[model samples]
Target: MPRTKGNHEARRRDVSEAVWRVLVAHGFGGLTMRAVAAELDATTGLLTHYFPAKRDLVAYALDLLERRSASRPRRAAGKGLSAVRAALLDILPLTDEATDSNRIWVSSWDAALANPELSDDYARKYAKSREKLRDLVAAAQQLGELPDGDPARIAAGAQSFVLGLVVQALFDPPAFPSHRQAELLDDYLATLNSPPSSGGDHEILS
Candidate 1:
């Protein structure tokens, strides 16, 4: 029987996710329609039905990641600083799932070096991500949980830190354990408070 449009759409998502899994597990080279078909238990033609070209499929998967990741911070905003930290950390490739994403993402980043066309997508995602981090850092400062540095700069630095951790995880997954990261984060928080030993400079480094 022919599937309805809704069923087809659901199946399309299933195929897309399957492609994502293959891309992460293997590499961009592994994201052939055959792989997605194997994962979805569908025919190779089925993937072509949804994404006529391999490039289209790649773009769709990348956009899906961008949108899914973009929503993490906004939802965490209501929960405040702790929530922000949790949400922002989600971007780091710490866990298996994040590592999977990073596998594909770093590949995409490398691809961008040779393909200027893909670089546009990278820039767009980067801008949106930095803005989200900026908002989180600004919120932390407002709550007195962070020092009153330039929020944008702090955001950039925090993003840099997470990026470093992600790259480190690619080589050594246990390098930046979450507990230690949290300890360092807390240490930074400590600096935000007025040093009783020093004069009255609540903002730290005063």
Candidate 2:
């Protein structure tokens, strides 16, 4: 029997979630239809019903990671800067769940680089995320929670900094602990929240 579109999408979502579990447990290298089927306690034939090819499944899995990361709880973002901070911190590998998601992202990168569809999809997702960050920065600035400057530039810098810290924390948790990451983020935002220097200030060097 032919499945309805809604049912097909629901099944796809369920299969993609199983794929996500396999990706998180085994990374990209270990992902396969068999592994995903095993995760779902199903046969590869059922998975292939929705995703006929491995690339299709991989793309869906990577897309799932992006969606999951973006959908993190937002109950903490009640204010301007706090909202921005909460959004940015959600991307970091701070908790066990976040760490697993970051690992999946890292694992998917090499494959994304090789596949044009994946690459374009990743680029689009990142561009959208940066735009959201820029909007948050602009909001904070308007609310006097952040200093006035180029909000776009600030957003780009913040994104880069967070990505770098994610890598560092993933590589060496002992050296770059999660609390330290939070402290550094607070310090960075504090700098952004600082008042602009007066124009009449003079510097003398010897």
Best by TM-score: 2
Candidate 2 on 18-116: residue-level lDDT in tens?
888898888998999999998888899988886899987876777788788778655477668998899878888888888888988888888889889
C-alpha TM-score for every candidate? 0.75, 0.79
Report residue 52 deviation for candidate 2 (angstroms): 2.2
Model 1 CA lDDT for position 29: 61
Instruction: Evaluate model 2: give its TM-score.
Output: 0.79
Q: What's the CA error at residue 58 for candidate 2, in Å?
A: 1.1
In every candidate, how many clashes are there? 0, 0
- List the pairs of residues colliding in candidate 1: none
Candidate 2 Cα misplacement greater than 4 A, ranges: 1-14, 41-46, 195-206
